[model samples]
Structure formats: structure tokens, C-alpha cells
Target: ILPNVTIRMLLISTIESLSYDSQRYLGNFIKRNDLPIPFTYYLYNNETNLIDYKINFNLLAEVQCLSTEHLIIQVGSPTTIGLESLNTSGSQSLRSGCIDTLFGTAQIDQNKEKSCIIFDVHGTILSGINDTIILALQQYASLQFLYVTEADLETNFLPSMINNSISKPTIVCIFDDHYDKHLHDEHVNLVQQFTNRYRMKNWSHVQWFLIPTKNTWLTQSDNKQYDENERIQTLRSQLSYILQKINQTIIDPTLFRTIFQVQSLYWSLLHYSMNTLNYDSTCYFEVESELKQLFNDLSDTTDNLLITTPISYLQSKIKQNQMDLPRRNKTKFVIDEVQRYENLLKKIDQISDHTQFFIDLLTKRTYMEVLITEKYLEQWRSAYEPRLRSELINEKHKMIHLTSELKRIEMLEKQQKLNKSIDIQQQLQTAKENYEQSYKTLNEIDTKLMNIDMTIGLFFDEILSISDYNSY
Candidate 1:
């Protein structure tokens, strides 16, 4: 093993049948001392038989530590009554094989019994046993040891693990180096069945490696560092592969939910504006443009696989929805215009009271002015005009008498009478001109009143026509 290699080893057996005290002591000793690899001990309940123990073992080995690279040693008599049918060879034979594959040689005590198996800090086997024993180990594993029961693995661990893996990514490796083909198949098939049942294939972030009896175990202690280094490099490569897959496939549910919420809010606001209040197309487009820009900016800010996928999806959805906006706004504008025209008609109809007041004032003023002008005309025609005519006749008679006498003094007196007649004629002419000017003013006022009435009538007609058109 390399100085930096982090190794984990598991020793499992029943408390009753195995040398529990010795295994526990050895595990503690390895953990307490400075060592390159770590060791853990697991003892089945004294009451549990080998069958239940095997089930527990398979559960932990296959599920809990699936992604971990660890050495698992079974410590018990293989020929125990309940376990005899489990494997063709004895438990000692399997232990011997594992030791042989790890250490390349076997060590024996004075009683010819296999002693403790030990690996130095450098992963050199200080003492062990060996021969043609087969060992299986994963070339690449990415996780550390995890202690869990079968029930926990099925009920809690697998579900949570799969969920977490979908968010990020993970690779799990399982090595089935057992001599029994049925046990090997059972171990690999169970995991496959579970993954299939849960639809794990849909998630591209998780990967599974199931290895069957491959004789790729390290044969020499000298090659331990090289093998571990190679495993680490392979794990790094796989991690890169997983990251690439995540970039391609992962969609952020949170981002999608957020975008959906925004889209819903925008639609709600649009509906409210169109149905309840003033709907300004220019203002709506301005707000919509801002929202689009915000979304685009958010998309540009992050390189996270989760955020990017949903952002792209929502952008497309927004684009599709935007295509219908112009048509919807056009309809809204027509509805608004119809509503405004209706309101204008209501306002015009309500002006009847004020219109009557102005009409009465104009008619009364015209009548009063016309009566005053007629009175002035009657004063001129009945009194001032006759007096002037009588004076002129009198002057003419006096002038004729003076002419008949041919006297100079009498003629001068007649000329004075004639001048008086002319002055009266001038006053009558001024009165007639005043009457004509008053009549002209009255006519202009009447024309103005008629124009006002025509304008009011036209306004009403336009409002009614618009109402009828809208109804049609």
C-alpha cells in the first residue's frame, strides 16, 4: 500500500462460533496504532444462526458498503452445522484462500494451526498463509465503510442514497469473489432487482459495477502501492465521467419550481390588468422585457448543471408564451376602447340638466334684447319720425311764402326754419341707424345659440353611433 492509501477492512462472524475476544482485540489494536489501513469488527447476535447472519452480511456488504473498497474476512468454522450447506469448501479454506491471495504464503504456529494474519504499515504481510486460494477485490471504489443493517439499507439508506446521487453523482462497485456461484449471483442480482424496481435507470448520475469471479487480486505485497494508486486514478477518472453526465442531464427542481411560480404570477397580473383595470400595452411590454432580462441574467450567472437545464427550459416556455401576448393585448385594447366609449356616453347623457340651464339663459337673453330693440324702433317710428316730418312741411310752406313776397328779411327767417327741419332729420337718421345696429347684434346672438345647439346634437349623435357599432 502507498503511504497515502486509505484502506478499510471488515471482519465479520457470529459471536458464539467465532473467537470474538481475539478478533475484537485485533481490530482495536489495529485502529489504535498508527497504520496505513483501518480495521472494523462486526459480530452477529449469539442467538442468530448462520443463515440470518449470512443475510445480514449480504445486506451490509452489498448495500451499505457497495461503493467502498474494503477487505471482508469471515471468521468462523465453515463446517458449523447450519452453514455447512452454504459453501462447498470449509470456512478455514476460504480464509486460507483470502490470506494466500493477500500474502502469497501461509504462516503456522507450533500446533500447526493458522496464526494471526498481519499486514505491516507498508501493506507488507508480516505473516500469513497462502496457496491457490482465489480472492476478489474491486479495482476502483470511491466510498468508505458504512455500518448498517439489512432493514435500514432497504428502508432508509438506498432511497436517500439514490436521491442524493441524482443531485450530485456516485459510483458503486461490488466484487463477488466467493467460490459459490449461487451466492455470487444472489448478491449481484438482488442489487440489480432493487435498482430496476426503483427506476434508477432514469437517473444518469448513479453508476453500478458488479464484478464476478475475476482473478485480478494483487498477487504480491510489493504491488500493493501500485494497485492502490491505480485504483485511486481509476476512481478519479470515473468521477470525471459522472460529472460530465451530471452536466448533461441534471435538472434543478428548485429552479424549475421558482420559474414556474414567476410565470404564474406574471399571468395573474396580466389577467387582472386586462379584466379589472387600465391595461397599458406599452407598460406591460416594458415590465415583461425587464422580467425576461432578469431571467437571462440569472441564466448567465451560474454554471451549475441543475440551474442551467431548468433555466433553458423556462426560457423556451417564456418564448412560446410571449408569442400569444400581442394577440391578447390587441383584444384587450378593443375592449378598453369600447368601455371608454360607453363611459363617455354616460357622461354626455348626464349633461342634460346643465344643457337646459344654458339654453334657458340664452333664450331669455335673446328675448329681452329683441323686446328692447322693438321698443326703441316704436319710439322712433311713432313719435320722433312724425314730428320731424311736420317740421319739414312747415319750413317748406314758410320758404314758399317768402319766395312769393320777394322780400329779403322774410326769406332769412324762412331759412332759419329750414335749418331746424334739417336738424330734426339728422336726429331721425341717427335713431334709425341705432335701431339697425341693435337688430344686427340680436341676429348674431341667435346664430351663436343655433351653433351651440348643433354642436351638442353632433356630440350626442357620435356617442350613440359608437354605442351602436360596439353592440353590433
Candidate 2:
């Protein structure tokens, strides 16, 4: 006989395994059916002696049942014989007995008052029995009986269970090898259905283990080498491994939460730095310092350091470029001012290109936050920058032509006394008209520049909205 603690641990492990498996199953079901529903799993172990366990279980069950549409409650090892008695009896007795075992007589009316489906599977069916049993315990409660060899469990039975379920139903499959290949294949196929439904890349959520029944019932001489405590520890370790396997299948929700915040902060910093580039020559150093601090903060909270490496490198490059900028304040000549303006424009282009590069890098990752950021970045890069650059180039060319015409007119005016020609007068008139056109063009460019700034501000606002919406 097993000690109470070992038995409790075993029961807990089994319930946890089933809970995770059901979660995987429901997750798949929702995706496959294209249903707008969230899934949750709750495990209740009535056989455990801990009063706290019972209290917490009841509290959670009540909360989950009311809160979620897709809720699964799995009760573990409720009676001495466990779920073994459900398979041997017909519908009426199965209902009465399993109901009492699962929820004590005191709690039966309360459990029956709630709307949920109860499902049971037979362990002995792993020897290859073909059976389908459905028991309606009450108007609100029902018990489903399934055997390992039944074809419908995968096809008709499970689909029906999910369809008829007011809330998500907990499915329990109990198996013992019996070394039968066909029976094993059926079980494998059943599990594969869930795996395929969930679109899992691996068997992380599926719990399959071989329990050493013979070792548990060993004679004193056979078990002389190992003490009771050692055996219990061994059993506990095996159960722990099974639970760990299931835990590894699902991505931690906390990681997504952290990534959401990090991605938002990253985009905000990029936007702020880009905007500051328009006015501040020393903004690169300041932005780089801020980014380094941000990276350090994120690195402390998450294991995804590699994802931030590109951004870090970009910041370092910006800092280096800032250090290399010419220190002279005012240009001595017009040509020097022109050169300075060109250098500033080139620096702005580099900043924009690098910012785009960082956003592109984030888009390659699979997180929703990254994808959303990428969408906004793509919109800005594709629509905003090219048009702005084209307009700037056009305006610069017009300014250059106007400057050349003004110089020509000055030369012509100096020569007008010497030449006294009608053609010179016409040329001067044309130069004045061209200068007036240049002023108009300059005004248009200024207006466009203001619009471009407003557009950029709007883009930043949209990004901020995305961050706010997804923060939770």
C-alpha cells in the first residue's frame, strides 16, 4: 500500500497533467473552430487531506466557472478506488457513485446546482475494449464514459463534448500499456489529434508516462535495497519530471508582458530621438545614454538580451558619430554654411536609416508587440520619408537655381550702363519674376515642412496609443 503523502502527490501530479493537457486541447479547439472564447483549466483534488487544498480548490472553481466561458474542472482521485468504479457500472449507478465520490454528499447539491460537464475514462480499456457510455446525472450535470479502443473518442465523442459543453469540459484519459500495439496506436492517434489541433511543434503539453506498477507492489526481498522514503522520493521525482514537461510546452505569459513593455519603450525612445535630431546637434549622445540605461533595465528583467544587441550597437554608433561632428559654431562663409547644412542633412538621413533598421530587426521576432511596431514603422518608412525627402530635394534645387539667377542679374545690372541694351532690360525683368517664383516656392516648402512635422507627431501618437492599448 502507498503512503498517504505519496498517494496525494501522485493524485496532484495526475490532476496537473490532465489540467495542462486539457488546456492544450481547448486552446486548439478554440483556434480550429475560430471561436471567440478564452480557455481556463481548474484542478480539484478531493482525496487530499489538506484543508487548505479543499478550500482553495472550491474558491477557484467558483471563480473560474463564473468568469470564463471555456472552463475545465478536473477532480483527481476522489475516492479509494478512484475512477475505477465508473467503468464497471451502467449509467444510473455510474452517475450516483461518481457524483458522490467527486463531490461529497454535503456538496453534491451545490455541485449539481452549477452547470458543467463531467467526463470519465477507463484505465482498463487500454487492454482494448470498445465502449461508449453517456450518463446524464442531472439536467445540469452529465458523465461521459469512453474506452481507449473507441474510434468516436477522437472523432465524434470529443467534438460533441466541446460542442455541448456550456463551459469547457475536462477530458480524462487513463491508460496502462498492456503492450498492445493497436490499443497504443489508438491512444497515440487520440493524443496526436490534440497535438495537431493545437498546432504544437513538440509534445511539450502532452503528458505520457509509464508508471512502474510492479515496483510499487514489490515484495520485501525485492525492495530490500531501497527504503520506503527512497521509493517515495523516486516516485515524486518522476511525477515532478512529468509536471515540468507540461510546464515547458506553454510560453510564459510574463515574458509576453515584459516584451510588450520593452517594445513600446523601444519605439518611444526611437521616435523621441528621431524628433530631437531635427533641432539638437547633441541629441545623439543624450539618446544613446538613455538607450543604454533602458537596455540595462530590460536586461535585468528578461532573458532576451540578444534581441536588444542590435539597438545597443546602433546607439553606440550614434554616440560615436555625435563625437565626430565638427565643433565650429558659425560658418565664416556662405559655402561653409551650405556644407554644414548638407552634413546635418546626411546625419539626419543616417539616423532615420538606422532607426528603420532597428524596427526591421524587431519585426523579425514573433511577438505581437514587435509585429505591431513593425507595421507602424513600415507605414512611416514607406509613405512619410520618401515623400519628405523628394520635396526637400526639389526645394533645394529650386533654391540653387534662384541663387544662380540672382548672381547673373547682379552681373547684368553692373554691365547695363556699359551695354544699354533692350535684351538686358528683358533679362532683368525675367530675373525679378524668377526671384518672386523662388519666394513662393520657399513658402510652399516651409508649409510642407510644417505638415511633415505634424505627420511625424501623429505617427508618434499612434505608436503611443498602441503601447497603451497592449500594455495589459
Candidate 3:
């Protein structure tokens, strides 16, 4: 009874029994039900009087939960046909119950690894089109229903919608009613506006699509039956492609969790810097306690991820590598993650070194604080200052080394492009240019990093300034 509800009337009849008048009546019924959401009908001739109950049940059940109505009529010999309406009713009940249970289970699984698909529609979407999308998603294992939210352009509502998404791998499908073979000017303007907003944010993780509604071809095609079939098929194909992308793009949870934990540890260390020191020994003691706690937490996190996770990852990578098929992006991601784990380990080792040096410096300074005299100042200037300068220089050089490692990764990416390209000579030339450009870019990054490192070094250098210690 809803104004936007779609109505599909399916007629399954034998050619011998479905008389001209019955067909005419069915056509009139369809015409009466036709609305903006494309209330459509499909006819299947039951020539052999054999019903594919499973396919019929699934197709019927797919759209049953939506605000749509289906009028299914079976016209065959009484002996050949059972009560199909009853069968459809039972199937719908079974499917709806199962879906409710399964959706709950899927939500629980989402806590471990969540991904989402968002649908943005100009108006109401028909049940049949939704049914096609469900069928397509069913083909992929990694895809699951997380949640759906509406996006409104009139209020500039897209940014809020994006922020509300909890999952990392998100796909947004914006269905425009005004898109035909050529997009309407209004639709084009809307797409441009939304795309500009999306691009401004540079949302790398979320994939965006502007999809034409199935009803676009409704008025364009004279043959309704053929056009509807084609429309549904096209919808199914597009859905499959998008779902497959989401499936492939899923990040391995172990790698994601590990990376996040490590990055958090790094930031925690940054906050635990020597700048927190007052001239009092208790201040140094407080920083040492916090630094030690950070080190313990970092060690525990890295131990769990590095020891157990990499072995499992390597085994999986081996299995994927042994497979005959071309490697998927996930396999490549695993390889990249292995490399990242190595980088993280090195960075952690560097952090450990820095932490240990500070700990030792604090202990020695506190020990000599009792003997504060001209002799102590001379000993500090001669002994500790060179060590402090050496450590500071080492820290500055480490930034350069880290930046080079990033440059190497960038070079590897260019090498990958060359490996995939068909024209080797041309690709080599392009790669050379890219390498040169990347090298130049990397030098600029190195300079910025050096400047940042110098700024940090000033803070450490201030700690060893001796004038600050002279106050004691």
C-alpha cells in the first residue's frame, strides 16, 4: 500500500492453458501496478509442467522482506502443479528467519574484521534490483552485510555518512535516477559536486561509484521484457564486480592490528621524551618510570605479533605462492606486510637504543648530582657532552636511513610497474624518469626530516647544556 513499494507479478503458465484473454488481463494488471519504482512482471512458460522450485523459491524470497508485493499465478494442469503460493509463503518465512539469525552472527564476526557497502539512492529502490544485488553478493565469501546508511546531497550530508562508517574497506554506490545512456545534466552536476567533495578528502580506503538505476531503460526500450532482463543482468554484473573488489581489498586483521599497535607505541614513546624533565631528580625518576613502562608495553606487543603472527602469515603466504593461479592483491599485501614487519622491528630496536641511552644518562646525572662542583662540571663537559652529541648525531642520521628505506619501497613500486608492462624499453625509460623524480622527491623529504630531527635534537641538546645543570 506504500506509495514507493514495488510490485512484481510473476506468471508461470503453460502455453496451452494461458489463453489470450488471461494474458491480456495479466498485462492490464501489470500496467495498473506500474509506478516510478518500476513495478514490473516477468512471465515464464511452464512447457514441461516441471517447476524449478529452488530457483523460484530463491528469486521470490530474495525480495520478500522489502516493501514489495508479489502476485504469483500458476496456470497448469491441477495434477502437474501443487499449491505454489503456499510453497512461496513457506520459503519466504524460512528465508526471512534464517537471514535474521545469520545477520546477527555476521555482526558478531564484524568485530574481528569489518567491511561495509553503502547505497545512496535518489529515491526508493525496487525490490527486484535489491534481489539482484543480494544474488551477486552471495557469490563472494569475504563480502558480508555490515550496515547501510543513506547519503543526502541537498544538505551536503556525504561527509557525515563517511565519518559514520566503522569499517576500513567501504564501497559507496550512488544510484542516480537521471542516468540513462547519457547522464542527465542534473545527475552530472550532482556527481561532479559529490566527487569533488570526496576527492577533497582524499579518502583512499573508500571506493565510490555512480550507478544508474535499473529504471533508466524503462522508458527507453519498447520491448519491456527484454529490457528488464538486460537491466537485471547488468545490475547483477556490476554488483558482482564491486563485491569482488571489496572481497579482495580486505586487509588481513593480524597485519592491521599489529601495525596499529606498533604505531601507537611509537607515539607513546614520542610523548615520553626527555623534555618532561624538571631540575629535580624526582622528575627524571618519573620519566624513567614512564619510559620503562612504555618499553615493556612495546616489547609485549611486538613479541605477540612478531613471534606468532609472522609464522602463520608466512605459512599462508607459502600456500598462496604455491597455487597455480596468478597471485591476488592479498598475497602481495602479505609480502608487503612481511617487509613492513621487518621495518617495524628495526624501528623498535632504534627506539630501544634511544630509551636505553636516556635511562643511562639520567642514572649517571643523578649519581653525579651529589658531587656538584667545578670538578663535576669539567667531568660532565669532557665526558657526557661528547656522548650526548654522538647520540644526537646518531638519531639525526637514523632519520635519513628511515627516509631512504621509504625511497627504496617507492623504487620497488616502480619496478613492479615495469615488470607488469608489455613494452619493456618504453617502460624502462618511464621507470628511469620516475626513479629520478622519486629520488628528487626523496631528497626533499630527507631535508625536511633532517630539519625535524635537528629540532628534536635541540631538546636533547638542551638537556646536556650544563648551564641547566649549573643551577644545581
Candidate 4:
């Protein structure tokens, strides 16, 4: 139902394009489509002495339907009109460009651009009343404006929200019969039951409201016009309030990006601890402490960096590297820590500069520890281990020489036994004493060889456990 003038213009343009023979069918075609036939009413004139013909024509019209008027106001004319019907949010100026609207059930997973979504739970997308609601919502650039079938609402939308898959702000408008003028008792129960279900989940950021269906608003009798206008105005106010709330509550993209950056660094730190450092149970305890503080901060969802300075638990773990944890237990601990962080990361949707700073500090500390380990290992390989090996080799040569000398002296003493030679006996005793001393020296060297590998590790503890490193 177009405006009366627009309909006349269309009729005139259509008639001009047709031949005279074809024009005969136009009136019947207009009646078939239920369009009002254009007609004229002439004024009558009367004269006493002379006949004076005064002519006038009147066109019949009815009150233009609100739905048609609103439709024309939106798409029919270039100039906007009739905006005084509903008061909208003040942020209308903020929604100037193209809106990122994701329609249908296919885009349920990709709604990061959506700040407000209108779920058509009752299938009102094709209705004129819904078109008006959609026009009202188009003032916001951040709105997703989805049409979720009732079946999809249960299977997709609700489940996705509950499973923590959607990351965008959850400002939703649910169109249901619960808010209808002739609302049924069962409708009230359904609304209450679903509201309780969502409340039980305790999603702090979620905000949703139920409104009357399209037919309830537009299909009322003429007697209910006042009530219909009141509901429509109320609907406008609700939409305005929800969108305003969304504007106030939506997280900044920079914050989310920063948060993800810290998350990546945190994972890198964990990877280093597990794979590169092969951290013992004590080390993992320190990691868990850091995780505890991180988890608490993330749970709040509004704060910046929440972990305190110095990380005393990690410092303590560095001092006690020789706690002697079993390999199997160590592996299990790492896996558990990984799983914990995985869950924690899933909950992270925003971050701040403070969080980035905190994670950077943690990463730097771990890097320094790695550097210290490498330095100690390098020293052992370059100097200490080689020196120990050289000493062992020298002791082995001395043992062989002394054994040969003792055997030679014993042979000479046996040869001179018949004459009872004192010189040979003295030589045999000196050679045997030298052999015994060499054997004792070689045994001491062998003992040192067995324990030499652990010296550098102890050195690391001594260096890293000092109070100076604690503050770092």
C-alpha cells in the first residue's frame, strides 16, 4: 500500500506507456489487485439569468495505514519523516557507516562485529511490523540483527552461548508472545522458565529482553490503536536502553588484542618451562602459583594486570632445583599445567597494557634463567670437564710406570737372594712404596671422575639462588 500520490503517479506513468486498446483492461486489473480506482467528483452550479458553469473535482482518500506510511518513510521517499514516534539512543550518531549485519543461522559462530542481535524466535522477518523494528535497529552500526528460527534457538544459539563459544557482547532482543497484549499464562511460564535457565548459568555480560510479536503489534483492531501505539513506543525505549547499555559495556578491541598477546607469551613461557628447561616439580609449583594469580585476575574480567611483583614462589623454585622429582610425575604435572592454562585462555576476551607489562616481565625473568643455565653448561664443557679428564689420563700413565719399576726390582731381588745383596733389597722396597702411592692417587682420581659431572649443576644453584637474583 503506497502513498495515494505515489500510487497515482505510478498509474499515470503506466497508462502513458500503454495503447488505447490496452488501457481498457487497466481498471479491471487495478480492481483485481484491490487498488482503489481513481475517480472524480464535480461541483454543481446554478444560475438565474445565464448559465454559469463552475467545475470542481474531489478525490477520495482514507487514513494511510501506519505500516505503509512507515515503509514509505524508510524506503519510499528521499526525505525522512515521522521520527518523533519513538525516542532512540543518543549513540545514533555513532552508527554512521555500514552495519555488520549477520543474518540467518549460518553465521551464529561469527558475531564478533555484533553488539546487538535481534533473534526472530517467532519467525517475523517477513512481516511489515518486523520491517519497522529492523529499520529502528539499523541506526546502530554494531548490530548483527539475526533471524534465528525457534528450532535453531534451542539447537544453535542457546547452546553456543552456554558453551562459551561466542566472544562478542551479548545484547539480545527476543521477539516472543510473552509480551503480547493478550499474553497467555503458558507464555508467561515459558518466559520465566527460560529466564531462570539463563540466570542459572550466571553470565554476567549477557543482557536480553522479550518483546511482543509482530502480529500482536500490527494486527490489532481499530479500537486497540491507543494500546498499540503505547506498546510500540515502549518497544522503542527498550531498544534504546539495550543499545545504550551495550555501548557502555562493550570492551575495547585494543584491550582484547593486548590480552591475546599476553596469552601467547604465557604459552611460550609454559613451553620453555616444560620442553626446554625440563622443570622439576618445584619449578612447576612456582608456575602454578603464577597461574593461580593469573586465573584470579582473569576471573574478574575487568581489571588489568593483577599479579604482584618479584614472583617469590618462582624464586623459591629456582633455589631448590634438586628436589628429586620422578620423571613420570614431572610429565604429568606439565600436562596438567598446560590444560589449566588452556581453559584459562578460553575465558580471556580482553587485555590491558598492565597485563602486557606483567607478562613481559615474567618472560624476561625466564629468559635470564635459561641464559644462566646455558652459561654454566658452556663453562663445564670448555674448561672444567676437560681438566678433569686430563688429570685422569696423567694418573693412569704414572700407575703403569710404577707397576713396571716394581716388577723389575722384584726380579732383581730374587736373582740376588743367593748372595744376600742389601742394595737390591733396598731398591725393591723403594719401588714397592712408589707403586702403592701411585695406586692410591689413581683411586682418588677415579672417585673424582665419577662425581665431576654434577659440579656445574651445583654451581648453577649457587648462582641463581642468591638474594640478588630473587628481586629480578
lDDT of each: 0.32, 0.35, 0.35, 0.39
TM-score, one value per model: 0.18, 0.20, 0.24, 0.24
User: Per model, how many backbone clashes are there?
Assistant: 7, 0, 0, 1
Q: Output the better candidate (3/4) by lDDT.
A: 4
Per-residue C-alpha lDDT of model 4 across residues 1-472, encoded as one tens digit per residue: 2323355346544654676545445644654565543321112234455422211001111111000110101111101111111212223222111111112211212232332222121212223222322222222212232322223334445544323223334544454543654334655433455556567665555556555555465565666878787777876776666656665444332121111222233344444542232211111223334434443333212221112212222343333332433444586665565455445434544433333434443456553233233333343333345666788799889888888888888887788878868888888888888888888887766655443333333333433433344334
Q: Model 1 over residues 262-359: C-alpha lDDT tens digits?
A: 23433444455422322121112222333234333332123211222222222333454456556675866555654554454344323233233334
Per-residue alpha-carbon lDDT of model 2 for 250-311, expressed as tens digits? Answer: 22211111112222333444456422322111112222333344333332123221233323
For residues 365-448, could you state the per-residue lDDT of candidate 3 as single tens digits?
Answer: 542222122222232233334444555566556556655655665566678774764455454566556556555655654443
For model 4, the stretches where C-alpha displacement exceeds 4 angstroms are 1-156, 161-167, 182-191, 253-472
Which candidate, 1 or 3, has the higher lDDT?
3
- Pairs that collide in candidate 2 are none
Arranged by TM-score with the best first, the candidates are 4, 3, 2, 1
Model 3 stretches astray by more than 4 angstroms: 1-151, 183-193, 212-220, 251-472
Best by lDDT: 4
